[model samples]
Target: MELYGQVLLIAMPIFLVAVLAEMWYGRWRGKDTYRTMDMISSMSSGVTNVTKDVLGLSISLLTYTWMVDHLAVFDIKATIWTYLIAFFVLDFQGYWVHRIAHQINFFWNKHAIHHSSEDFNLACALRQSISSFVNLFTFFLLPAAVLGVPAQVISIVAPLHLFAQFWYHTQHIDRMGFLEKILVTPSHHRVHHAINPEYLDRNHSQIFIFWDKLFGTFQEELRDVPPVYGITRPSNTWNPVKINFQHLWLLAKDAWRTQNTRDKFRIWFMPTGWRPADVADTYPVEKIDDLYGYVKYESKSSGALKVWSWIQFGITLLFLMYFFGHLGTIKVPGIFLYGGFIFLTVYAYTELMDHNPNALGWEILKNAFGSYLLFSTGDWFGLNHYFPQGLYLIAGYFVLSTLVTAWFVRKGITPDNFVTQATKSQSYSTLNTH
Candidate 1:
């Protein structure tokens, strides 16, 4: 648990640096909308995803613990060389596990949950299925079992690899020059997340870009090659379970419907979204295009507003740094507090930026639930003992409900204005005609 806390400490600073870097890049590119609502929506989705991953990681950790104990009969020697070997071996195993997760239908169903997001941000990195632990653990444990590396060593190193991955999820940084050719950069990863036909199933590196480059899966992101983000089909809400399982359900139905066993097998092994028979692909390719679409055209920024926004963004960055930095240290009433803080930070950022008003209700509900947990519950609700992690998780439903509400509010904002403007324009045209 202390190690987990330490990982969070290390991660928070890296996250802050990434945020600052992204902000600077956004400003430099003149695309600094930085709406609070969009941030809230993205963050809300991120918190829910992170909770699921934590649960999954916990289960995986337990499984690895058991494996380590059983394998102790072999009396594995722990040395610096063993640790180094374990690290590379684990990463190599991760490469295949991640690759298969994208390719195999059973795995892709769970993996697709991460790719469902329309927005690319740091929080999205945590969005993965709890079931993914099964895939991740099965592969890495093989090394420990065969090579006789201690379970303690595997547990510590595995998370370090994961912690190293969070910053690669952001859209903030461009290419890192020479580093882009070797290590996976935000630029390299953005290509992986891209839904562009040219980019699908490309850039499958976990710790090193060399895997993709050597294997011919690498596609260098060009300024002319605008990225289209999100999956071909978008999951509409922050519901972790649905996000995780929906693709699996679809694949199962497809496999069941196919008469030939070969076709059934093919459906599972083929690239995601492949069907034995063509049914018009259900996912909105255009919507994905819109989400990742980059305009070569530039927007002019007012010098004063740009500077003011930067200052405000800087303040928010500091707040997030402190919030995440102290998160593991503080014992809260429920798991929801952590989730609420994440949701609030994102929503507050987006709201302040005027990107999405739909995310506010979810943020309110999350805050309400967190407050309830903090003040209303005594030890009866396991406040002092276990901290009611499940109760806090209930805010996820409210967050989804609020997003739905925001959709309506957004629709109302536009059409009403358009209708009034149309009416006024018609009236003026009539008078002019007379």
Candidate 2:
């Protein structure tokens, strides 16, 4: 956990720099791929994913260490060849894991957040799953176990393998000449992320492009066909927490609604986006049918609302940095408390971005609870040691943010306002014509 925190301390800034650089580069080329609310939601999704990981909130169905201890066949020595073998084994395992997530209805919920963004940018790369508590991919590591790869070796390489995937999520890089055949380049990954009919489920490789090629899932980026990013069913909201479980909730509802006993039992393992026949007819969910008619999910936000959302995201990020630095000192329960605060902060601000009126009330309640917690605790998990006056600044921030949020809410600061303005203008013009 400490190691993860340390690595994240370095990684978080690098990710920010890369995303910002991509945004700037896109504008330079006269195209803006970064939407403010979409980017915020993407970054918030990353925060939840990392928080879940750093808190060690996962259950293992089978232990890799146990498998390595018992299934040793080769007793391979720890050398460069073993590391290469391990890397290939890991990538192979990753490909299947990625494939199943898209193929199965139940498992797709955990992965849907990654493809939920309409715009493909580096920030969207951070849209990882927070609902992934079960570690059921142990069977994929059997090749490594048979070869007698040590658990220590896996622990070292796993983070590197995951981090290796982050760079390819960008739209900036084009086709690489030689590396195109070897590694998973940006073009290859873009095909994977696209929802266009041709690119729907192609290119499931993580680090290597060969896995997709060998498995018959490879589709090269063609000049004639452009990739349209995002899933068929738009989530229509900016909350990552909600996006994580939206599909699962649909499955649960279908299981309850369907009269057929067998259908209820089998719905989870059915193909992706399948619903019980009766339930599908009675409670029809609208899916995007026409490519030309598709509208990206967006809310009307005044410039003030946009600036307010950024301020909230920036504040939550600073608090996250503080939590990571003091991770060792904060007790387990305190870790959860602090993490919960950060999560709620994300939920509140994101709800505001969605232009949900209820968001103001949620934010006000969250701040009230936060203020009381600090007043009673008198410290932010040992942060008082660094700066005695910091708590005052934090308290003032909570109070002031709540007030600012309330003001925005009272101003009718959603896209709905634009519609209202249009109606009033039309009415005045009609009166003048009469």
Best by lDDT: 2
The C-alpha RMSD of each candidate to the native structure, in angstroms, is 10.1, 6.1
The residue-level lDDT of candidate 2 at 141 comes to 96
How do the residues 182-212 of candidate 2 rate in per-residue lDDT, one tens digit apiece? 9999899888887778889999999999998
Clashing pairs in 2: 300-415
Clash count in backbone of candidate 2: 1
Question: What would the TM-scores of all predictions be?
Answer: 0.62, 0.94
Cα lDDT of candidate 1 equals 0.56
